[model samples]
Target: MATRLNPYISFAGTARQAMEFYKDVFGGTLNMSTFGDMGAPVDADGIMHAMLETDSGYTIMGADTPPGMEHRAGTDMAVSLSGDDAVQLREYWDKLSASGSVQVPLEQQMWGDTFGSCTDRFGVTWMVNITG
Candidate 1:
């Protein structure tokens, strides 16, 4: 195994729904553990940890906010997807921006690449860049 860096999101009791939504968007295998699985005296159905590993080699991890933690809903960070695969990237962008707010429409950017940013329905910000 090698070292890796990925996003670990904290949701306000919506980790299950959000991770499921991401699985649909990225077409991945999702493995989730619940609070009850860890013997924690919380909502049995609440996700303690969830991981989505996509065919595109993307790994997304998340969980419901802990029993005594704050979950803020804003873009202090954004997950970036960049590659030369235009079709796949566009497909991802379409699905991600659907039913969500688009901060920037997907189009050619000043940097000479196709770029866009949006907040998914789960309130997670994503930046997609298609390189030529």
Candidate 2:
């Protein structure tokens, strides 16, 4: 199998919801495992790990901050999505910006591309760039 590099996000306690929201945005199959499933004494429903694999071959994995772990928001990390497909990328921007804070509106950039940045409702930062 070929090696792949994907983002692994960490959530405070909303990994399940965040992963589900991503599934809606990217149209993918999500497989999740919880602490209880792993025989951990943490919250039964707290996600231990979740992976979302989209049809576009995008893979995002995430997990909740396990017990005794501190979750700090805005730690200089952002998940970036970039492609030449304007329609798909715009759709993602719309969904991601809804109910979230937009740091940069999706529009033409000086570099001749459509770009935007936002923090999702779950506090995960995202950047979407669409090539012109």
Candidate 3:
């Protein structure tokens, strides 16, 4: 397979819930592995890795922050979804901004597109852009 760039999020003991939320939002097949599955001494139920491959061809991976690592949210990056599929993109923006804080409402932008940004309930930042 060719090298691909995918967003991988790190959660603090909430990886399962966060990943499941993404599955609901993006309509995808989610595969997960736990610490126990990898014979780790940490919380057995903690997510070691989780991958969601959406029908829209989006791939998101996430995991519980390991014992020695820090799980920082919304400090450095944002996940962006952009395309000409207005209907589909609007649907995503609705679901994502429903329970979270909307940094920017989804509306027509000066760039000639509908754009918005929000922080999902899981504290992940998402930016959606729908081209005209």
Estimate every model's Cα lDDT from 0 to 1.
0.91, 0.92, 0.92
Off by over 4 Å in 2: none
lDDT of 3 at 11: 89
As a TM-score, model 1 comes out at 0.96
For every model shown, what is its TM-score relative to the native structure?
0.96, 0.95, 0.96
lDDT of 3 at 24: 94
* Residue-level lDDT tens digits of model 1 in 1-132: 889889998888899999999999899799999999999987888999999999989999998988778779645678999999999999999999998999999999988999999999889999999995
Segments of candidate 1 deviating more than 4 angstroms: none
1-132: candidate 3 lDDT, tens digit per residue: 878888999888999999999999999799999999999987999999999999988999999999888778866779999999999999999999999999999999998999999999989999999996
Count of backbone clashes for each model?
A: 0, 0, 0
lDDT of 2 by residue, 1-132 (tens): 789988899888889989999999999899999999999986889999999999999999999989898898656589999999999899999999998999999999999999999998988899999998
Residue 70 deviation, candidate 3, in Å? Answer: 1.4
